[model samples]
Target: MKIGVVSDTHLSDRREIRLPQELLGGLSGVELILHAGDWISPRVAEELEKLAPVEGIAGNNDGMDIVSRFGYKKIVEAAGVRIGLIHGDGYGKTTERRAFDAFEGQDVQAIVFGHSHIPYLERKAGILLFNPGSPTDKRRQLLYSYGIMEIREGEITAVHHYYASWD
Candidate 1:
């Protein structure tokens, strides 16, 4: 199964800004999309659902409506693999550490998280850690980015897909 992962779309609070066309292009053909949150606008998920089925966790910047809708963490099972999802927003510990703690003792093979808008991929202790970064808000990063993950025969292959611009 091929999955598109994304996070930290800090769009406007009141006025809705359209998501990047390039993001949809990058996500094209994926069976599902996993959003790690900070999707400030509800429209973010709405727009993405047009491409494929969407699921997400809530972030620190997310309003109550969003928080209530998606909660703080999730576990997704697709094509015989389990993926844990979190926004990586808590008062203590590093983002990656927090992510690990969220699903401790769980049966997930991969954990997808975001809070720092920096792409990350690591394998530790039998789990794949992934952060898709922010396609709309790169902050100090040089380029906008997202991630793609493929699961085949009980193996996971994930890579960051960087773009020069989201427009």
Candidate 2:
């Protein structure tokens, strides 16, 4: 199965929010979409659902309505792999560690999180940690990025898809 992963889409009522065309194009053949959070509007999920089913958590920037619909964390099982999802927040100097700790006791093959608005993908202690970064808002990064995961049997391979411009 192919999955598209994204995060930190900080869209609000005050600003025009549109998914990056590169993101939508990259997700063309995906079967599922996982949003790590910071989706300020539920419409973001709605838009993504037009392409594929979306599973997401609420980020710190999300409002009460989003928090009520989707909490801060979730766990999903697909292709025999258990994936932990969280919109990591409140860890001063050890954000990655805190994200990993969020699913500590759980038997997860991977953990997906976003908060720093930085793209990250690493394997530690037999678990894959992935953060797709922000496709619409690249705070300090040079490029906008998202993630793609291919799962088969019990193994998973993930990669980042980056573009210099949203256009």
Candidate 3:
């Protein structure tokens, strides 16, 4: 199964709050979509849903509505692989640390998170850590990015895809 992953899409950054073609166009061919949070508005997920099913958590920047819909953390299974998802917020020295700790004692092959708006993909202690970064709000990043997670016969393949602009 091929899954599209993204996070921290601060769509509210623009006055119109319209999604950029770069992002919408890029995530076109996936079976599922996972968002790690900080969507800022429910409209973000609503737009993504047009492409594929979306599952996500709520970030510190999200409002009550978003939290009510997705909560702060989640665990999902795809292709027989368990995946933990979080916003990478709350008490931890770094976003990565917070994300890593979120699923302690839980059985998960991968942890997907977002908060720092930095793209990351690595394997540590037999688990995959992936952050798709912010396609809308890049912060100091030179390029915007997102991620893809492919699972086949109990094997996981993860990667980050970078782009120059959101538009």
- The top-ranked prediction according to TM-score is 2
**lDDT values for all models:** 0.91, 0.90, 0.89
Error of 2 at 42 (Å): 0.9
* Model 2 score (lDDT): 0.90
Name every residue pair that clashes in candidate 2.
Answer: none
Comparing candidate 1 with candidate 2, which one achieves the higher TM-score? 2
Among these predictions, the greatest lDDT belongs to: 1
What order do you get sorting by lDDT, best first?
1, 2, 3
Off by over 4 Å in 3: none
TM per candidate: 0.95, 0.96, 0.95
lDDT of 1 by residue, 1-167 (tens): 89999999998657767777778788999999999999998888888899899989999999888888899888999889999999998877989999988999999999999999989999889999999999999999998899999999988879999888855
lDDT of candidate model 3 versus the reference: 0.89
Tell me the spans in candidate 2 whose CA falls farther than 4 Å from its real position.
none
TM-score of 1: 0.95
Give the per-residue Cα lDDT of candidate 1 at 52.
92
